[model samples]
Target: MSVPHAKLPAWAEYGLIPLVNLAVAFLISGLVVLIVGESPLEAAYHMINGAFGRGEYIGFTLYYTTTFIFTGLAVAVAFHCGLFNIGGEGQAYIGGIGVALACLSFDRVLPWYLLFPIAVIGAAFFGALWAMIPGWLQAKRGSHIVITTIMFNFIAASLMNYLLNRVFKPLGSMSLETRTFETGGQLPKLDWLMSIFGLSVGNAPFNISFLLALLAAFGVWVLIWRTKLGYEMRTMGHSPAAARYAGIKEAKIIVITMMISGALAGMMALNPIMGEQFRMQLDFVQGAGFVGIAVALIGRSHPAGIIPAALLFGMLYQGGAEISFEMPSISRDMIVIIQGLVILFAGALEHMFRPAITRIIFGLSPKGRQAAATKGA
Candidate 1:
């Protein structure tokens, strides 16, 4: 009861499969739009317009893309090490504390440039420390990484809630956030960059963090593809036993990988806190952590792929808001459903169409035909 299956080329494996899955997801989403008594094509037009019609919209879209890029790289890094670091939301949450402390301590004394690097270090350090516990447990105690990471997320949320409400809350302020950061602590907005190019974006929250995100992506590319540690991580992911046999230390790799992943997730705090909010606040992470899972899956866990994948999801988010505003029948929840569909197709059902693709490829290949003949015989 065995049949020969064709092997896809590298391009098809990395590029075409994801494209086909995305196309299928959009087609189904269009059907759902029809059921809601709306024109899918019109809805698509609105979404595109909302995300990129004006300078401000483009700015906002890139702003969201920046966060997604950080979080996506976080997840992708963990995936390469065969670890599921689902605690990115928690890591980002706690990273804010580092950002807050650094800003509060030096905001008045230090220049913006000096304070900025300190805050960045704080964020990465705290996030890495938070993730280290779970990573240690998984490596030394044989605990499941997914379960431990998920538990850490809840712990982080409760910890943040207590800190923000009891310790950081300013007098006479009912909000669950720290006082606004001093001028030196705040990041410079990208409005100047826009103005320099004769493009006005009307106070969009996009800032220097966007450039940092791009830099991070490039850094990850170098780390994952051009370094010895990256080779070990990928080897362990493929076969832990093989890695051990090859003299790679599994425990050390696991911990180091998670720390790096946590650091990336922690950096996401810079965008909302320093760049936009200018203060530490609850729920700042929103759901970018979870969305990162889908991004990593769809991007095939590569930095080059992650950048565009992050941009695509950013479009969906910015455009989804616009669609809900313009169409009476389409609620924000409907947009959520569409996003869920994309996740489903790209992640859970990714291989659903592979068998058919294999069949077609097999019919056209000599090696596959030889294998098929052997099977038939």
Candidate 2:
């Protein structure tokens, strides 16, 4: 007879396990800092102070958070449908093209309010269209999503390069970027929102897009947990055979889910392009697409979990920059190492400490101990 193992409590599974892993990661990272001849506690203080010490730093952190939130949701949504859509980088790149087309063509005539919606729709449509190719391949041709999506990223980069250099480059301009967007195309700053609370953010990039990201999170929650389509997607993810028995069309779900994921990733372009750069430029994505994978894993592929995870990464990014500037001993590469450790612990090694923790929890719980005793007999 096989002995049954006791299940961990929800709190231990969701809460304690992650905390222990994070602590271990940080502890290891601290050792790395010490080895490099720096004080770990001082580094920690600098990171915290840099990320949230001032109103401006807070704004920058939140600005980064907005991009991660959209991409993380994109990853999470597809994960729910059992799809690994790694094309967020490409989707976001094409989405920026869509936004640029809409803004450049109509910014002179349309009001900002009217233009913004058009830009958003363009971004979503183009993103979905780009992703449709990979989705169709996966659904119809049986192509693996991971391979196709990675290829699509390279394709997107090349396409954008050609467009920016040959097609959209303004006359008499040497830069590999489009002409500056018209005033009407620009997104208004949210400094007034801060001012309402008697705080100033000192020209940070945080904008209305932050609110849109939050709304997207709520929307993802509803789409995943409260809808029939979501149910079908989840069912398909759990078991294709069972889903087929229930008459859920796996192909349709795969395609639709990927398109939705692509759309969310595309929306991330709005923050950097319209809100910050005010022009279409090369490399605006800055690897936020890839970062979504880490965010999704750390967040456990849930919208509620994704928000805090995105914010945490945002803090790491902003704080990392600050510490690198202040402490020459802690280079940018060192900061990346620290970030890598977090990702490693949160994702790949997430369960490394789970068994030990489970035993401890089991020891402390009467019901758990009783179950273990019964199983042993």
Candidate 3:
């Protein structure tokens, strides 16, 4: 007879395992630095200081964190529903069109506070609409969600290129972007929020969207844990056959979940478009959609976990830039390698240490000892 697999406690599964994985990733990253003839300690010092040394650094880090939080939550929502919504890149791209339309139509007439809500709805609606098509195909036509979503991403890119070049491009402007938004369209920076920490925001574009991202996280937690639909979603994710047996409508759940995921991804555009750039630009997403997949994996698809994971990635992005500037030997590509190592270890190889850790835990528990004795016999 085969021995049953051991299970980890919730705290160990969610918290301790991830921490150990991160530590190992950093340790390996240090080895890479050593091979490059630089002191790992020195590189680490610069990275930490660069990410948090000054208030402006924190602001920039949080600004990146804000975008990641949105995208991370998007991936997390879909993951919970047993769906991999890889079309976040496309959804966010199309969502920008919604935001731009709202701003272009109302920027001259409405104040920022008033336009913000309208823009939010517009963003979410367009993103949901974009994601809904793939969800429909998967639910109704038996198409593979992964292939459809990935293809939608490329389609979104092409669509945006055409729209930007032909429709949204202002006449006589050489740039392939829309006209810059006025004060009404621009989001207000959270200078007061920084002031509470006794630091100025400086040139960082950190804005109200960070607060919005937090709100979205809370909303997700409530939706996933506190609501009936969430229960159905979790059931479907755990076992579609059981869900169907329990009378849960898989088709409805898939579509709704994907729409919610897409909506979250779409809102990410608000940070860069309204919060910073004050205009939609090509490739403003900067791969946050793909980064979100790693974020969700590292976070274990929990809203609480995703917040810190997003912050960690934000640090990597900001600090990596600093590393490139401070140490010419470690170029931008080198920084990318460092980031990739972290993703490889933390995301892909996440369970590599689980069996060893499980054995250690089992060795320490009385019931586990008894079970082992029984298995051995």
Candidate 4:
């Protein structure tokens, strides 16, 4: 039997704790900057300016944010079902195949408005299918999801490499990518959205897919909080034995949850495929799938939390580039260290301050007071 833990107030759990962790991360990062003989304040100023300085900068930041949102939500959904899915990279890779096929088939005959829905379906289907096999093995064959998912990512990369080189590459092109899509296959930029803020999108690739990512986040919120299946998922996540006793089908839920997670990951391909690249390219995921893990961790596996968490990473990525450019002494490796520190505090060390926080808040309730006393003893 497990001892019940004291719960923090919603404000502290959701807001204060995360803020504390972020502050610590920045402090450590500042120390590193100082050790390297640069002013942390100046580096921070440049980072902020780089990520949000111009209309184009903001657009690029949001573009990266859009990809992170889909992948972050993917990880979050599986987390709610008590599963860790590390195969978002592979799922997104396979999903590119679906997007490419759809665009190649209809680019000449159909307008983007008509093709977009088909591409969405194709991306979702392929992504879900790729994820289902691992879920099935975990459910029926006792395979570990983390191990299997990791293996699948390697498999996916190999499969895509073969397909691109032998199958999809156009004749005599001497390139690993397919033919670029025509106008009908390309998604329109969300210049109107930028204009509303009196900003121009400029050459940034922010597009309709950003809006789609926001809608998907809203849909995930409804699914996790409003639907009956979501209740079962949460219950299972809390305790598999209890969920089983309550008549929730564990096997079915696992498969479905994995599929949903994969579909969201697969949709990540849409941002690069239609919104920016306008064609499938090698390794276009650019490690966003792995970044999703950190995003979900920082977000606490909630859609509402996931959005801002995604934006934070977006800022890190865009700003890291600026730091490298403006402060050559800082170096790209130094920027990576800053990001790694944030992930370390926000993810691996998330609970480092929890005990102290609980002690501070534990006196408000008789139960909490008793628990604190019991812990002290």
Q: What is the alpha-carbon lDDT of model 3 when measured against the actual structure?
A: 0.89
Tell me the tens digit of each residue's lDDT in model 1 across 199-309.
777767888988989999999989999999999999989889999999999999999999999999999999999999899988899888887887898899999899999
- lDDT of residue 289 for candidate 1: 84
lDDT of 2 at 136: 91
Q: Arrange candidates, best TM-score first.
A: 3, 2, 4, 1
Model 1: pairs clashing at backbone N, Cα or C within 3 Å: none
> How many Å off is the CA of 182 in candidate 3?
0.3
Q: Which runs of model 3 end up more than 4 angstroms from their true locations?
A: 1-4, 365-377
Collision count for each candidate, in order: 0, 0, 0, 0
Once superposed on the true structure, which residue ranges of model 1 sit more than 4 Å away at CA?
A: 1-5, 192-198, 361-377
* Clash-forming residue pairs, model 2: none
> In model 2, how large is the Cα lDDT of residue 280?
91
- Check candidate 3 and list the clashing pairs: none
In model 4, residue pairs whose N, Cα or C atoms come closer than 3 Å (at least 3 residues apart or on different chains), thus clashing, are none
Assess every candidate by TM-score: 0.93, 0.94, 0.94, 0.93
lDDT of 2 by residue, 20-77 (tens): 8778878998898899898989988988998899888888888999999999998889
What TM-score does candidate 3 get on C-alpha atoms? 0.94
Off by over 4 Å in 2: 1-5, 371-377
What's the true lDDT of residue 354 in model 2? Answer: 70
The lDDT for every candidate, in the order shown, is 0.88, 0.86, 0.89, 0.90
